[model samples]
Target: MGVYNVHERLLVARSGEVGALLDTLSSGGDGDALWPHRSWPPMRLDRPLAPGAAGGHGPVRYTVTTYVPSAWVRFAFSGPRGFHGFHEYVVLPVDEERTVLRHTLAMNTGGPARLTWPLVWRPLHDALLEDSLDRAERACTGAVAHPARRGAYTRLLRRLLRRPPGVTGKP
Candidate 1:
């Protein structure tokens, strides 16, 4: 099953500023000042963000398939068991004082992902992207005008992950 996911945020900075910050983050910089409040495994690339570069943590992995400085970037999945496709980030200038930062994921899930995606991955994915956008906004404007909030499902999942295995209260 193919999944197309998109998340965007309007920043007070121009495309160049926001794009530069994103580039820094993607390059594994020490700029925790603009850190995204991520609930999922953080992305770590083996090299700077560029074509053919590869990275990802946890159940996700991909290779940089396309890159355009200060504008856009694309990554093609190479792992995570059943993810086949790409994701990208684009910085669009709304005007000199505004920019739109968009992140898009287009991929087909197979094997267990078909089930895990809908039942588990989707919520986490959405939350992650929203947080990413929030971080981008903070990076540009020095504040998160509207921080991303996790839905009930995401909160519940977090609780479950913290539980001890085989400790189910019900028989």
Candidate 2:
């Protein structure tokens, strides 16, 4: 529960859309990234009903947990060998357009690693969080350069069926 390298900043020239971007990333995490996550359905995360589902960018109360890739989960599980839970927090400006994003990776411990958190964990966490923020910024700015865009399931099925012989096992 103690502080672990907390940071807060304003993105200046960008705030509203930026805030929207943060909300999208924080709330749109479904176990499967391929699905149409930006919606309110069984597949999509249900925002936490604790605070209330009214957000400046949109309506949402809470999400069960932000979706990190299996790889991230694996790293969190293996790299730190004690305790088990690290949740993220996406804080938006209460009044301004800027968003205050916090990815607090926490755990319960008093082991050797805990002793070295200042020296080791801080640096590791810093780098990881930096990458996360950078990506979030890209999504905010509509400049996510290149990562294959999502398409409908039926479209993919059709494409697979229409593939040339060389593209598939058909002869």
Task: Give one clash count per candidate, in the order shown.
Answer: 0, 4
Residue 52 displacement in candidate 1 (angstroms):
1.5
RMSD of 2: 13.6
Give lDDT per model, in order. Answer: 0.77, 0.39
Candidate 1 lDDT, tens digit per residue, 1-171? 989988888888988898786676454435532335245555777887778788774557888898887788888998778888888888899999999999898989999889988888788778878877887887688788888899999988767755367664311
Give a tens-digit lDDT track for model 2, residues 1-171. 233444333443244454444444324455322113332121223342222222211111222333332111111222344424443444455455555555555555456655645544455345434545555555555444443332354344334435466653311
Candidate 2 segments whose C-alpha is farther than 4 A from its true place? 1-3, 12-79, 83-85, 106-108, 142-171
Give the CA lDDT, 0 to 100, for residue 45 in model 1: 77
**How many clashes would you count in candidate 1?**
0
Alpha-carbon lDDT of model 2: 0.39
